[model samples]
Target: MHEVSICEALLDQLTSLAAQQGWPRLRRVWVRLGLLSGVVPDALEFAFAAMATGTPAEGAELLLENEPGHFDCAVCGELELERMDFTCPQCGGALQLLRAGRDLWLSGVEPMPS
Candidate 1:
């Protein structure tokens, strides 16, 4: 799966950040996973665990925070959709996507105790 590649990139970023910030070991990695990002959480976690071997991030907990898809309706202002639906419930107007839930980013990190 592409999650492996994603994890590789994530690890690269983590490595750079750790060196820049002088973190010896990482304890936790926090990520924001959008609902429609097409990346499976389980797959990502598995990839991370597999790829993190012998690295500073080994044994690090990968925490995911889900971000819901958001839309803007002419009549409803804003709406949060759990699934794909382009119609506004209130006025049946066409909903415009404000956030497509395609965001994937590292939000925070926790380092091991010195």
Candidate 2:
């Protein structure tokens, strides 16, 4: 799955950051996931566990924060919180997804001395 690749990328980034900062070990990893990011939390977690094998982040916890999807209505000038459909209820206009929930960001990393 793509989540495995994503996890690999994250590990790479973490390794680079740790090397750059001269950290001893990684403690935790904070990630922000969007509702429409097309990523399953369970799958990501599984991938993390599998990919972290024999790595610095083997014992690190992956903390995920989920963000909802939102859209803007052009006709009513209203911001709509969308879960499924992206149709404006007020003006019946097509809603534009202002914030596409497809972000995979490494928010923070905690390191501890070995």
Best by lDDT: 1
Candidate 1 residue-wise lDDT, 34-95, digit = tens: 87778889999999999988778999999988877889998879988766778987899999
Q: State how far residue 70 of model 2 sits from its true place (Å).
A: 2.3
Provide the TM-score for each candidate, comma-separated.
0.80, 0.75
* Clash count, one per candidate: 0, 0
TM-score, candidate 2, is: 0.75
lDDT of 2: 0.80
Worst 10 residues of 2 by lDDT: 77-86
Model 1 off-target regions past 4 Å? 73-75, 82-96
lDDT per residue for candidate 2 within 1-114, as digits (tens), equals 879888989899888898888886788999988767777789999999888877778888999877656777877774746364578877778887777577688989998766
